[model samples]
Target: SKMFYGGVKPEMVSDKFSFTEGPSTDKEGNVYFTDQPNDKIYYWDWKTNKVIEFLNKTGRANGTHFDKDDFLITCSDDQGEIWKISKDKKVEVLFKGFEGKRLNGPNDVWNDSFGGMYFTDPLYERDYWVDFKQETP
Candidate 1:
């Protein structure tokens, strides 16, 4: 279903990557999206119409969000880790294995006002990956 607007034409952004997910935005209206299968973060500068890769080897980063301090919080699928990336490119591992058990691969996540994180775990079978046969958290 397509909605029509008066006197407005739809424009498309240039394609740079595939498997786009984890769409988020900063205070300046710049859009951020992830290429999950490629393990990369991409940024679209709204002002200049430029797209760029923010990070590589991003732990197969999937879902992402901006924290209150504007840091990028991402669920890294490859290492099953949660990462907090500061503006100056400092990477912090917020969480790895829960109770000494590897997660089912954190699929999505969010942070509370007090910086508490709530994430989801779902079993995802990959070509080179094994089952996460651990107790659920």
Candidate 2:
């Protein structure tokens, strides 16, 4: 069991975030993750092996998956929406609600091969919300 990890001991990479969630890898092997309570996103550089802050004010993004085009598709749930974040840090809201009603929250996202996405709308309310209510049963 000594060689369980090739003798590599566990080391703390970074710390100091309210909560972390949703890690997705890019085409180049770098990993991106979120700190939802702090509204931030960070990535681990494949070449440098360093954690880098990718974005802030991320709308309480929880889960993420990369699209075919390398865009970081995110479940930005602050306002219950899905956002596609470009490499240049451009944010495009892909969805907001259903039937003109606000979604409870987008908790996760997955992209299909045919350029479509499937996401989860959970009613787990957040303190940052104004008046939490489930728009969908």
Candidate 3:
């Protein structure tokens, strides 16, 4: 048998959200993604083939990844924090800031086999901010 479904075509899953970003998958093949403008996270269940709201009021998360322990790690850009959401829907702040300064914004993340995580921080001025500049670090 072929390892992939060669004849499959791309299909639009959902169009109800504003903007989607940071899609990741768990060990069970369930796909998770975030809608940054709407502050929500959604999931595509592998068994049911349905897209459902996994989390709301998600701190304007832009990027996400599933850690080894099955926790949903998210870049909560609204507050410049990294969050971890568990299976039971509990949220925890994994990272807050650096040297008393707020992070620019976490854009994406990846986890290594050794339980280390790496992410990108980029500065982007948002409408909600009072006085912020986009700068390179």
lDDT tens readout by residue for model 1, 20-115:
888888778788878987888888898998887888878888888888778888888776788888766788988888888777677787777787
Query: All candidates' lDDT scores?
Result: 0.79, 0.90, 0.86
Q: Tens digits of per-residue lDDT for model 3 on 32-120?
A: 99988888999999798799999999888899999889899999888778999998899999887877778887889988777899998
Model 3 alpha-carbon miss at residue 96, Å? 1.2
Off by over 4 Å in 1: 1-10, 128-137
Model 3: lDDT equals 0.86
Clashes of 1: 0
Better of 1 and 2 by lDDT: 2
In candidate 1 the C-alpha lDDT for residue 27 amounts to 70
Estimate the overall C-alpha local distance difference test score of candidate 2: 0.90
What's model 1's lDDT at 61? 83
